[model samples]
Target: MHKTKKNKKYTGKIYRYTMLVFVISFLILNSFVHWQMQLQKQTKEAKATYTAETMVQRIETYLNQYQTKSVLLKQIVESDENMNMVKFETLADFIIKGNRALRGIELAKDGIVSEVYPVESNAQAIGLDILTYPARKDYAALAKKSGEYVMAGPLELIQGGTGMLLINPVYTVGAASEKSFWGFTILVLDWDTVIEELNLDGLDDSFYHYRIWNMDIRTGKQNLLIEYGDDGLKDELLVSCDMRNDTWYVEIEPVNGWFSTTEFLVNSMICILLSLFFAVLFLQYAIHRQEEFAHHEEMMRAAKEIQEANEVKSRFLFNMSHDLRTPINAVIGFTELLERHSDDEKKVTDYVKKIQLSSNILLSIINHVLEMSRIENGKESLNEDTESVKELIRTIDAVFETTSRQKNITCEYHVDVIHEYAVFDMTKVEEIFLNIMSNAVKYTPEGGHITADVTEVCEKDHKALYRITIQDTGIGMSEEFIPHLFEPFARERTSTESKVLGTGLGMPIVKALVELMGGTVNVESKVGCGTKISVELFFEIADGKRAEESDQKQEISSTEGIENLAGRRILLAEDNPLNAEITVTLLEESGLSVDHAEDGKMCIEMLHQKEAGYYAAILMDIQMPQMDGYQAARAIRKADDAYASIPIIAMTANAFEEDRKLALESGMNDYIAKPIRMEIVLDVLKQWI
Candidate 1:
């Protein structure tokens, strides 16, 4: 009877403990569920905020770079006094040059399409009447007629891309208002480069649905141009950027963000788990409630630790990356300075080569970190449009040409398949080509053959498919590792003797770029044999013509074939002593007489001393002491029968929009950015003098 009473007491205690445990578990679980929900909500808002911030930053960066490039170009165009080239020809050259200069803007100079840069694959734009295209001809016409800068709609530039166009008029000296002489200088850029790069850097891959639109707000509804993944996405992120005359909208819908049918099951499982544990405790024996509570507490603590560690690591890496670029920038900039001053041809070449190599290395590191970040986060994809295959191949060849020569390798190039220009990003393609071609040149020994070829595949109606093959008789790869060729950070194990070294992001980037361009890359290799990398792409353009003929031809020789610089009056206004000396040496080599000035005041003094026409052209450096070039030039313009009407060309390194404006406003005609190339200087002199 006493034992029975003891058992009853124990059972009652167990029941009381069980009830207490249920109440504690209920509150804790409820808190956890609420926190998880809040966490998810916060994650979504954070992602959107981050994406928007990053997009805006990149847009601003690209625009600033492009603006700098454009101002430099306009400065050059107006100052070229000796340029006998017609306005049409000038416009042609400027377009091609401008496109090369600007990195990420969708470009269109509506008023004129020059033949120099010509219409390579302008099938989408060449015809179909710009008159009918509201954005192109109409706004461009107004800008040209009005002699002012005009911005157009965020229109679809080609079949694969969205961009904005900027048009500005070119007027004569005495022209009133914006409506003046010469055709318009149109600048167009596809925004996808930075946009997609940002997307690659941000989004996770398994994301079920995403939609991106280059929004046009004409009819109250947003126009979706580039949509990805799905139309079924519920929660979304919308970001706006300044697009031409208006703004661009980018919307992101992550699949993981939305509650799926699978999610309902997950929530059901949670409910079942809670109900089963508590319900069973009531029906069955209630025991060890305290231990179970302690275990749940332990698990939560562990998860918190792991999350904190990961966050710390991410912050560290981001800070390290931020710190890295500063030193790299200094190195690159200083090396450029050294290269310009080095008068020894061989030394100059070697220094330039090293600079290029260093730049490429830095670029590779940046790309690697960026790719890793993107891959880890699951959002790396390509949004490629048509690019010049010829330009890409030529750049690759040029990059390795000197290296190949040093190794005594015969670098043969052939284009059989690339009949028409297709869509792709030049920067990404350049990176891929650099990686591959650099490897080829690095690994191949003397007398080895390295051939680059582009050929055709089976074609469909009116569109011809093409394949680009780069085959190198360098140290070959093993057959065992062909599958992992496209994988990140995997260098071929078999090519052990190959001196070529890389961050292993090369092939992966190439693969990504190819996929982005809507293509495939296949590698075939044998031990002790050679490696063949075949990249296949789709290409078609109406009236398509291959660029192989011209691009593959002899490159523009760097040396200016001038007889003499002696007796040729020259003006030099420069602040940097090293550059000035180098310029003097280069000019002396061409036998040119040179005059020097420290600032605009001195230049004006030099001009005043001479009677009518003293110097061929005043090389007025932009930034200087005691009446800067701009102010001095203005004074020269306002000279009362004293200062000569000399052809004053700006010769400074201040390459920016405002700089160009101030330079032009000060009465100087031409402007040149620093880190001066001798060829550009010579050409400038020849054109003016």
Candidate 2:
């Protein structure tokens, strides 16, 4: 009887332990399955959003290209009011030949279509009064009223099929320079051809269904254009693309819905199996618990470290964002002031100067950010060139002379070097010194003294070790802050509190560049007293003959006369209309006649069509739609024609040492970084032309 009682007790214990293990395992497995389902749904939704956005961008770009062409046609018509049908046909043929999506081009005279390209099949569109058409008249009127381009339809076309119409209103200039409406320049885009060109149908796959539609503005109802899958779409993921006068929506959803029933069933079965397996192996789990505990502790430490790093980055970003906005806000505010006080000459002048100052500050912040990014990504490299130590010091002095004088600060520089010229990365060395000096000047109170001392420490193996020390009687940092002084976005005081403007990336950049050049940097500061920074760098002594040759070349280059630039004609190849307009204005203001090309391809064609000596130079932008500046430069050089030797200067926003080198390598005569100052442009132009 006692033996029977013990057996019963043992069986009850086993049953209880098994049930506990099964319950725990089932709960965990079910939670994991739920988590997996949520993750899958999130991933699908993200992908759908991405796909929708991509389609929108592609369609917008396609539409914008036709809009640009339409504007170009309008410009041609307005320039020559007597443009005959033969001339119109020739221009239309050129515009429509390469693009398969274009159905045809039409010229409407006073809202009546009088001309159509490819007159055979599209003749039916000729003489059709577009303004009288019920479906098209509203958009036509809108185009005329707004004095801008307007888009209409996926409506039935007289030439057959469905298409969209881009209407650009043309205006004629009378003898008194009065403008009158001259009807429209219309571009017909075939809907099916657009879909085929953009591969819209291919976006749908086994995993997802998509629908594209436009809203009818008149009726406030969705006009479904294309769908790939089921009859009813839930509009789970929707993205709107804005065209000229309409917004098109792309909606996407998972084919199997957000949660898959089949997947859920499979996961549930696996969870059940896993629960049973865990119950069977419950006794063995205790054996490995100690090992798992140790692993968990290690994982926790790693996660803590990762979190700390993330927090640091977050803090840095927060500080940078605040610092970046100060100058930007100043620029924006001053611009508004300038606009409001346009008639006041003195206020306008003052506001313009303030705007320029703010712009410079904004540029400095951007430069610091870019420099830090390059350093962090390990993309920065030394471009070693022979540089004069005296010249470097002179340049720095010249830069700060005005600011120091304005603030009543006495800034002095002392240099004692055995070698005057050394082979070093001039840009990097200049940046390091400039960054330190700028901070010293910024923080130093008015009437305070600042000094920069440069001396040769030692020489070995034909390399000279130079030491630079900058000292300032300024608001020094706290002892505790010194440790984090070289960290990115580290600042001693907030700009608002200190009344100082800076990105806080300067010192970090200085430290990074110093380290990159196999150098050391040290700082000494006391809160009430002052701050002094010392940097030691080694540079190879440049060959005397080479240094002399470089100096002579620089002298000769600087002496080149820019007077010849007056009345000179040059080609400005740029894609953006605003940039092109700004550049043309600047060039024209400098007494130079400018001919603008929309892209590299157009620039090349214009060159080919012009006389050999017509254009004195070509200012080519590096990034353009068809054939970039590099390819254009190379082509021009390889043509071996009379114009092949024409000077091509790269005027682009790609402002980096490597970019300049690449431009030169691609047969460009010179490179001009944009935000183009007229003086720099003229200097560069004078050298080549």
Candidate 3:
């Protein structure tokens, strides 16, 4: 009797569990169906929003293309040098050539398209009436009226769907609007291109239908310009344009965006329910917590492994750099010495050039590494201040004057000094001027003129500021490279082929600095012509308007610290023998008094005991073992007796320019470098003396 009762109890327990599972499965499945329907509805609304925005962006992109192409075409029509009948004939030839070259630029003349770019399948459009055409005629008329820019709303084609056009009126030189309207330049674009690029195919397996509509909410023109799919599911949108410039871009564009996807939700519900069902079966309530703990531990172990590897990588790079710089410096320095002492003049010149090239490479690697460190450390902060226009320009001129003269390129400077001072970071200003000027000189073929001008643009609000325009008659850049000019590690099409290519960090650095200083950079160029870079800095009227000086005769002579070092025998307090050797070489070349002291203690001993006129200055190294330059300078400055009068200049391998200022601020007279330049030593001496 007891055995039978126990069997019945076991059967009842099994029955209860099976019934419970059945009931739960039924409830979950029904709930999933309801949730999927809601998800589809939400997807539909999201898709609608995305579609609205993406459509706007597509229209804007096409409009921009139209505007640019129209400008190019107008220039062809209106140039005085190209207005003759033969030139016009040549222009027609150019039109054909350009059309064949580019995918999206077309040219129309006298209401007839002589050339349509790409020479696509449609040849019937050639010699057709562009004026009477359904797409371009209206925009051409507006261009005639405005003489500026005219954009058309999206229009539906009589044959099928939607299109858009932009027009600009091209005028001849001094050509009256009535006489020189030169038939309007029309830019035609099809919006379907955007749809083709952004459509989602293999990513989603659900019902999603996407369509794009321009945000012509203002123009009252809601012509459906693009549609992505024919599925009944809600559409998705990726990007939209009617927002803030940076945030204005729409992503998860329409048609694939928040669109009703009943199928997607149903599938998702199936996944969630399946997950819960398995979770309940395999995982007991107590074991579920234990499984979570185990998963966390596994993740932590993986994370720890990655962290250890990263630490090792970091150490490796650090050690590699430390090891590499020593050999590199030795190679470069000895190579320079060999080139200098070489008997053959040509070989000497070759070696000298090679040394320069090698030094540039070393400098590039250093800058890249240093830049990475600075970014990681958050140290590249903008320290802005008001700077003098004349001083700034003169400093820039001093830097590039020799190079410019070498190329026989006369640089004419026009400074609107009346608006004298600008509130910007001086360091950044120097960088911007130097980079642009260097490129201008490098790119402008020999003998080309470079002009840098600053003018006060009259503002409507009675607030006037400075406009610094640096225009070079150098080999200008291609239109394609313009967008990427400011990207780091990006060399232009010309830059790559030219012998003057740099580390490619200059322009990006310039842009970052300018933005930090609250300024903007503008560029315009034509291939084979020249490039003009106009940088507009926000200036506060601090020093009053200085005059516009087209030419300034101020010259930066090869400095020897000549005056500062005059009769001042500098006490060379350096511990490193290699650094001491280089210092002695540069000092002798600059014609200065340099007395060697092995370390800071020796420096103090020599200064304490030396005769009154034995030393006039001390070029201290900041990181000496016995005592650093800062401490030595402070001790010398604090000296009560005769030694206090002698000046100390810190010579350091630290290339941060601010370090020099820091040395001076710490009671030192000036600072120079370890691998010192003869000119710099001379300049420092002249200034201090």
Candidate 4:
């Protein structure tokens, strides 16, 4: 009996200990559940806050870009005292086409809305006076008073659209101490489109629903500009941005609301389960932590990549600056020297030669940049014509022979051709050869050998295949550098290369042009040895009839034929006085009678003043005051006057193929891109007149 009693007491003690253990474990589980719930709540709120901040920053950046564009447009308009509507329209079209968020642009002159681009969509808004509109007048008045750009809108438009407007008041500096007010340049911004442009579509529904409201209005009233989601949710995080004179508020709420019955039940269930499955919960938490760590590592790597890319871009820009400035500085400095040493013919000639070389270098850099743009836009096209293979080879040799000889480099050129004539684009051929030979001359050391070997590979279907190999015995390049040699701005940082000046665009342009011409370019180089570049190009052989005709033709031996244009009268219409004077002097020097007009309007008037055939040809500037060259040409073509069929040559600085096409489409007989060479002008005159 005593032994049984002792055993019972021990069993009671064991039961009590087990109960105590259960109580302690249950309390620990409850504590964990509470902590988890608190942590989840904090994390959700934190996430919502961070998302809102990021969205705001993105929106701000997008808005600032538009704002900056608006400011630039304002400057463009205010730059000229007599701001032409056509120019403004063109500028506005370019801007609107490039940016989807911008609906259109409106220009007001003397408080009257005069012009609106994309007239089909915003035609009804044209001629609407901003000073007379009740809703827009206050903002216009404010912009005028401040004489600055002012953000206005989210207001109802009279044209039946709701959007925002950025109004910038323009003022002209007068001869007196006072400034004259010149109406406003307004940018119409589509609000919904802006939200789309900001890419804030799904963010509203994913993390939190938000409402943007403006509280500071002219009428001392609060108004909701835009809203998304749960109206009854009172617990929300509020963020505000100062929009000019208004306080723009964004109120966001968690999708599930702060106090949710589902959340409470989930926490309770989790607390109960934690008592039994604490190990599993710990494992899941550990996995989540590991995922977070990996995400952090990925983010760090991405940041590093971004930094490296930025560094590369910065270096590229720096190199571009150095390259561009070198030629520009040389040109300017040599021109000054020429002006000072005008009396010394030899010194003047040397300075002029240096200036010409510098100018050529500058033009090459510009061409490379423009060519890249054309390639990117898929606008690069080939202009094929019948070319004499011998002449082409001779021209290439002529181009590099002098430079190569000056540098003491033994440059040799060899051409093997089955036919003397082939159909190819001469301009593209010259560009490719010039770039390659220029590089060969620049990179090859003094006394080094450079050989250009050309051979006909094959001929079938009237298409001829040719291979061109340019080998230079100079400090070549490392294997790794060779791979990136054709990349723009790529250069190997070697001691020998440091003294060489280049845009680093030659190989890239050459490769691009070769590929465009349906050819392949390959390079083989080893450091301390040499570099050899090979290109294979295909061309169509000129037909027998054309080849026979070309063979029968002989070169003009004298300028007596071209002298027929010397006594002819020419009409030159240019806006800039300096350019016009220079053109007039050139025409006079060529023994041609020149008539000057300030603009296209004057040109038309001047032509009307003369009889048919009085003026041999009319040189028209495309961008002029009253009427552009295109419109003027069209007007002249439609006229019933004698000069209706008179040859019109477009003279403009626009050097694109599209510009040439447009000029021809506008009834111009010929197109001359400016920085006009006198010889080219004379040639055009000889052809058309």
Candidate 5:
């Protein structure tokens, strides 16, 4: 009996241990499964949000292209109030051919369709009155009343289809110079074509169901523009974007719900098997934790990067505001002073000089900002041309001559280049040198010494590497700040506190332009002693023919004196009356007669009516009403008259190098950037005429 009782006790112990093990395993498996499900849910949410954002971006981008095209049409119509069928058809054809999403472009006069491009297919749309149509009238009236582009549709077209319409109102100047509504420029985009271009249908078929929709402004009801995949989208993610006057929403959801059933089942089976061995289950759990930690680290890194970008942008804006306001304030204050002391000639002269200095500062800031933007956008490029190395060094020295002399600073330039002429982007090279030398002059105190050394370091494969080192005895930078010196909008605290006038974009632009040319820039500085900057750039060696050609061109560009401008009559095409008056006054004061035309069209007409050789040259402004300078230049070049080849110089505020290139390509003899200096004007005229 005692033996039997002992055996029963052993059996009871075994049963209890087995039950405890099973219970613990079940609990562990359940917890792991729960964790996995939650992870899957989070992943789906992130993916849905990302997909919705992507869809919105794609839709907005596609629609914005068409909207921009419509605005161009509006500009054309407003410029030429008498726009005929041929011109309209030509412009429309160009736009449509460039963009495949466009179904047709139409023009409406007094709310009636008067013209349509691709006339054979959209012939029925002609003569249709959009004002009388119930489906289109509201948006058309909205566009006319608001004087902004209005988006409408997925409505049936007169040509028997469905499409979206972008309507832009056209306004023209009446005889009294008052604005009057001309009509509308309408752009039609087929829905299916846009969808295909944006890959919306592919997204629906691949993994997620989506809906693109908007709220009807008139009805205050949900209007579905596009729907794809399943009927029901549970727990959908929605994102909204604004286009012109409308708000568009993109909603997305996984087709198989948030969590995949097959993945869940597979995970559960793996977890159950792991539970049989506690150590294996623990290892899996640890690995999962490690993966989660890694993911969190990645997310934190991304967040940090985004935060840094925002901070940089904020700093740039702050510096821009301060820099821009300084010169503007000076200009305004000096102008007021001049007006108050109008009768005092000395005070007026002083104030005018100050205003001119401030204007120069303002222009410098604007140019730096534009240059930085071009660098950031990867739009800056090298326009390699044959340039004299010696001339380049001399130019930098000449540019800083006055400033350095006024400061009592000694400037020295050393050149050891073997090749007299080499192919390089002369403009960018000049910009780099000027920027460096300007800073040196601005920072250096009186009696400071500055030296520039240029040497041809090596030559191989028809390329010569040139090294330029500029050293200055100035208020140098701290070693810590040297690392950030090439960053955009980076400024030293000492410079800012001293009220130094700069946009803080010079060094950054220099660095970008250098790197763009496959060059290197380095800086070394001491706290109170001095600073040194070194740059190395490669240039292609120019052959004898190129060097000879460049020398000939340079020789032709030189002129005798301003006296040569006497007795010359030139046509000035400027839209702004104030600018025209200023230019005319300046030219007349220099012994030249100036005839002013209000716009490009008038300029062309005046040229045509005048006898050949009556005008010495033409000064054309780029942005004008009726027609732009490019159009005018081309028309003059194509004219059947002796004066058609007359010298035309573009004088405008489109001051980039590309603008100058375009002006020359448009049949202009030369270009002069505005906020014009009289010396430059005289030099250009001498070269061309």
Candidate 6:
């Protein structure tokens, strides 16, 4: 009876313990499954964020490249003396081929579609007036009015396809804020091509949904530009892009609403083993956290670098504004005063001199900055011509003589050359000497001494090496700063140098110019002692035959020998009314007969109407309507008329070496840059007419 009672109590205890273990296991499994689901959700969100961000970056990069191409086209058009329709068409075709999204490019002159690329395909768009068209007028007006790039819809097109159009307005800036709208450059992008390039259709399988909304300035509403996947997703990641004059928003989310099939399977397999599930889950969570921290750190570093670059750019702009405005303000103020006091002879002379001084300073600043930019962009090249070495030195001395006298500084120049002439770019050589000498004069204290020395180093095989040294007695620089002297915008930051007015571009430009000319420059200085700079250059010695030709040419270039200019008939082709009037007045005052042609077409018509050799020469402005100077020159060259061989002198504002070469290539006998000097015009006339 006692043994039976003991066995029954033991069995009851076992049953209770078994029931408690089973209940605990069930509760633990439920918790594990819930935790796994949460892990899966977090992984999916992370993946979606990464994928969406990557796509956004890619899209932005693509758009930026296209934008760059558009901007380049605008620059080309603005810089061209005459816009050649054929050349523009070629450029457009190249762009379209390079970028699959671009369907066509169109150019408008004052709202009229004057040119379009892929003529066979886009012939219908060639004559369409952008301002008069109902579908395009709004965007065209917006772009012109805002003077900024305007992006318009994936709207239905006249060519039976949908496309997005980006319109950019080109304007010619007049004095002050007065802007004359030049025209419009249009970039037409196929909507389907854009979608494909952006891979919007493939984003669904990539586990993300995307929606793009562009704020329409016209409607004052946000219109959907593109959308992919379901809009009903609960969680979505959003990114905003600031386009010029418009705002665009891009929203993205996971297709499965934060649920991931891969993560679910991974977690489920681990959960089946129960014991290993917790350990593996914890390990994975730690690893993921570590990766996230690393990614955050990398992002922070990149952001910091970008911020630093932006800060540098801001500082550069500040410096440029201050430097550029100083001389410009002086020029403007002095000019206004001179104009008002024109009646007083003595005051007029003094004011005019002051204005000229200020103008020279402003031009110096502009030239330095532009030269540096050209050098950095690898566009700078030497245009060599036979020049007298002594003549060049004399010109330099004349330039600085007055400045030195005003400052009471002793300025001396010396040259020792075996040959009187050399094949060199005289303009570049003058710049090299003037920049260095100017620096010396600027840095030297009042009554200090500045000296320039040029000597022939060696001569071999018709090439001569020349050494130039410029020394200044002024507050000098430390040895440590000498190494960085050739860097752009690098200046001594000492109190003694703080008040000095400089563009900080002189030394760098000098260095680049010297290097470009196959030369070397060196500097020696001790703080408070003085500074000395030496440059060695190689120049080809001009042969006797070329030298004689140059001398004969120079003789003909003189205005003194010209006695029959009054009998010469000249045709001036100019578009701007103001420019035409000024040019005509100047020419007539020089005792020459002047006839004006409003455009290249008119100029050609006038030439064709007149008898052969009736006009002595044609002074052509490069930019004109109906036709441009280049095309006119070509047409005249091809004409059978005797006047076709008459001198065509290109008077243009495009004043670059490349411009001169192009002018020559286009059959122009001579080229003169505008802001036209009467003296130069007379000289050109004396030579050609």
lDDT of each: 0.60, 0.82, 0.61, 0.76, 0.81, 0.76
Question: Looking at candidate 4, what is the lDDT of residue 122?
Answer: 80
User: How far is 79's C-alpha from truth in model 5 (Å)?
Assistant: 99
- Cα lDDT tens digits, model 3, 282-320, are 334334334344478785776588779989986656433
User: Per-residue lDDT for 284-393 in model 1, tens only?
Assistant: 64434333344678857765786799899866564344323322543455464464456777766765655664455455445444554564455755445555666566
Question: RMSD to native for every prediction?
Answer: 39.3, 28.6, 25.7, 35.0, 34.0, 36.9
lDDT of 6 by residue, 330-364 (tens): 55655655655678999888767666655655565
Clashes of each: 32, 0, 44, 0, 0, 0
Clashing pairs in 5: none
- What are the TM-scores, per candidate, against the unseen true structure? 0.33, 0.40, 0.34, 0.44, 0.39, 0.43
Tally clashing residue pairs in candidate 4: 0
Give the C-alpha lDDT of model 1.
0.60
Instruction: Give the residue spans of candidate 1 off by over 4 A.
Output: 1-432, 440-451, 456-467, 471-532, 535-568, 588-592, 623-645, 653-667, 674-679, 682-689
Candidate 1 TM-score versus the reference: 0.33
Best by lDDT: 2
Candidate with top TM-score is 4
How does residue 379 of candidate 1 score in lDDT? 70
- Candidate 2 wrong stretches, greater than 4 Å: 1-368, 495-501, 558-570, 574-605, 611-618, 622-650, 656-672, 675-689
Taking all chains together, the TM-score of candidate 3 against the true structure is 0.34
Candidate number with the higher TM-score (2 or 6): 6
